[model samples]
Target chain A: MSTARANRMTPYLFLAPAGIVLAVALFYPICYMIYASFLDWNPSQRIGEADFIGLRNYTKLFSDAAFRESMWVTIKFSMVVVTIEMILGVGLALLLDRNIRGMSVLRTLFILPMMIAPIVVGLMWRYMYHPTVGIFNRTLTDWGFDPIPWLADGDWAFASVVIADVWQWTPFIFILSLAALQSLPASAIEASKIDGATGWQQIIYIKLPLMLPVLIVTLLLRLIDSFKVLEVILVMTNGGPGLSTEILSLRINRTASEFRELGEAAAMSNLLLIVLLILTFTMFIYNKAQDARMARLRKVEEEV
Target chain B: MSDKTYDRQNPAFYALLIALVVMAIGPIYLMLATSLKLNVDIMSDSSSLLFMPTLRNYETALCDFLWYEPEHLRRCDPTFGRALVNSLVIGLVSTAITLVIGTMAAYALVRFRFMGRDVVSLWTLMMRMVPPAVLLVPVFGIWTFQFGIDGSRGGIVLVYVALNLPFVIWILQSFIVQVPIQLEEAARMDGAGPFQVFFLVVLPLIKPGIAAASIFTFRVAWNEFLLANALADRNSRTVPVTIVNSLTEFDIDWGVIMATGMLLAIPPIIFTFVASRQIITGMTAGAVKG
Candidate 1:
């Protein structure tokens, strides 16, 4: 009886430490954030002393032009970056799906940009974008062309940050899509070839359809990450020249730290969290539907 | 899959590959080159590649660690050195703690049929999407007023472990699921308890998973700046926080800063080269599995 009791308790005992930590550190904080969002809170005052000005922060944020601009910038940044990365990454994956020597070496080299600290990535780009001393401008001047203000002009700063992000993260999609492409059941492709399908046709008709699931998940994951991007942009432009490069994360940081408006920052965080949750749930639903389809297919196979 | 046979490629194809490789490594090469060059070389519009290298920047960044003071140094700023130590301690300790509890929790979820496992799964998935920025406000508030653990390494470690645990558990669960049940049963038959079976049998089988998880955990803990910026005081600043703090200066030391940036980049770079396969595996498992 005691042994049975011990056996029943084993999982809980195993789970207890992690559960306790997550509850105190993650779950509690999230709850606190949601509650704090409704209050007129600031960094100087304790949470208890803050006025319970319900929905004012949210209302103020909607009316606030700066917050709206930051949201638009965040959305614009995510869209541009993810779209460009997806195209370049998936295109490269398709192009290089063949067996080649030094592929591992290539992969190792590719991941270096991503594996390095984002701060370092920002630093590298900042140096490369340095107006007078930068590589791009230096080359342009060498060619007798005018130097482009990479991070100085508003439009160029957005483009420059986008370029930096693409450089760092394109490899992520490349590697994933490559894995997806490589893992594709070869028999389907073989059958397609036997049916006189060309390389392009094979990619479009067969390979792409099979890789769709992985691609969607990768896209969503990248979307979530792009929203979370802060350090690189913070280091690069500090959301400056104007509000041109100020994404939501940077705005949130500035709000809490610079503006000292804790409640507004919390509200901004909640809004960002909601957007992410939608993406996450979409992915989750897709996974569930896929799992169900797989189960049903397996059941049919077993029956057959 | 006799796909191992190499394909014949056009010369243009190889040229394209070379171009791609250059595009990938160019900025990193520039950073390394810049870090090696003197301020004079960096400032001068000489030919890009022909400069005598120097370790002066590295010496300047790591001045506190050097036994003998170099002749060029006037005043040594100890911030980078101290930040480096704080980063390592916080990263390693948090990774260790996260892996320990994370593995156990994952094992439990996998090996035992527990109520609320679905709930746990949903929670983990939800938690994974909560950006560090979102946590900045609440974490700052709670750490400051409620926990009183603000401005300490332990506080930073606590948040990191929490932030990383969901992913670690989610990843390790898949690995633990693949551990053959009969092996654990055989161990149990030989008078081993549950913990013994877990530690001795299941743990050894999942070394690759653990390696992958640790790299990711350590990467996040090491690279994270936002929360660390909020949580860490001057004395407890990580490399990322210190680097950001220094960026706000009127006149920047590009060479020394690049050296500091290079130092921060070194571990992850090493990890990538050493375990590129495992890192790729972890990444694929993360997105592809989801």
Candidate 2:
């Protein structure tokens, strides 16, 4: 009887360690964060000592201009970076989807920018954007053009970060879309070609429509990641020139560490979590819908 | 459009490809070059490409590890070297812990139908989106106050394990699912216990998944700065935190700093070259499968 019962208990036994760790380190901390967001907390005091503010932190955030500006910056950064990366990445994928020599070598080279540490990426970009000794300004001056303040000016700093992010992340979209492209139905493509569909038509009508599901998922994944970006911006501009590049993540760090307002940082974190949860849920629902649609299509074809 | 067709591309396409390759790798090459250059050569506009390379910057960055003291150094700052050691230990330990538990969890989830795959996937995806910054405040409060694992390598390892568990579980599930159930049943028929079935049968087959997951976990633990900065005391600071701490100084040492950055980047670069296939597979598995 015990041996038979052990079989029933095996799954939970396998799951227990991961479950305990997640419950303690991840789930508990997140719950703690949510609770702490409601309290007036700080690093100087223990959580038990902090007063329960009951949504004062959230209300205060609504009126806080600096917080709102960072939110705006975060949104603007995500939208701009995601849009540009999607277009450039997908376009490059479509352009390069052909059978080419040295493709895997190119892919290896491409992923190097992403695999490196973001802090290191930030360091490289910061040196390259140095006002006087940077490569860009040096080359510009050598060519008789004016040296621009890449990370000094607010607008320029934002653009500079966007460029750096695009360079690092475009390969992600490229690789994903290329995978989707390569895995596509060869019979359908052969039929389309036999029907004399032009290259642009094939891409516009069939290829894109087929790749939309993967593209949407990629777009959402990138969007979620772009919001989490902090280190590179932290190392590059440090959200200087009056909060131009201060995304929500950076703002959260500053609030917690610099301002020492744990409560407010938790509130900011909660807000960011809500934003991400919405994105994740959207991806989940969209994926479910796509799966259902694919099932239905298969059912219909089988019926025919 | 057929898979076997050999399309003759124009020379312009090749030119564009070359340009893209250069754009992709130029900055990394620049960083490597800057790390090799002396401060004077790095600052000088003329002969930027013609300067002889030197190991002075590397020597300075890694002076703590070197047995013989270098002639150029007036003082040795052991912070970077210490942080490098801490990073490796924390990264390796955390990756090992994460993979061990994550593999079992994935095996259970895949082999035993306790819950729908979609539900677990959604959970993993949600957890994946939780930024380390969001965990900063609560993790600081909890680790410092409640769990009391704060300011130690164990504490940092705990957080890294937790941070990486969801993705590791998710990736390993896809890999474990591919392992045939008949093999497990055959092992069971040989009178092996459940643990033997898992460790002997399941674990060996999912090596690639573990490889991919370990690389990712190690990368995050090694590259992470925000939480590590908050949690690590001076003694346990990771390389990333030290790099960031140094950058806060006004007069940055471009050559030495780039050398530090290069050191931090070397492992991930090596992983990319060695396991680019697995890395790409791990990256696309979620989106393409979706």
- Tens digits of per-residue lDDT for model 2, B1-290: 33655678999999999999999999999999999999998888795788899999999999999999999999998988999899999999999999999998999999889899889989988998999999999999999998888899999999999999999999999998899899999999989889999999989999998889989999999899999999999999999999999999988999999999999999999999999999998999899987
True contacts kept of 1: 0.84
Expressed as tens digits, the lDDT of each residue in A27-108 for candidate 1 is: 9999999999999999999999999999999999999999999999999999999999999999999998878888999988
The CA-based lDDT of model 2 is what? 0.94
| Candidate 2 Cα outliers beyond 4 Å, as residue runs | B1-6
Could you tell me the fnat of model 2? 0.84
Cα lDDT of model 1 by residue, B1-290, tens digit: 35577878999989999999999999999999999988999999888899999999999999999999988999999999999999999999999999999999999998887756667777798898899999999999999999999999999999999999999998898898898999999999998989999999999999999999999999999999999999999889999999988889998888999999999999999999999999999989967765
Clashing pairs in 1: none
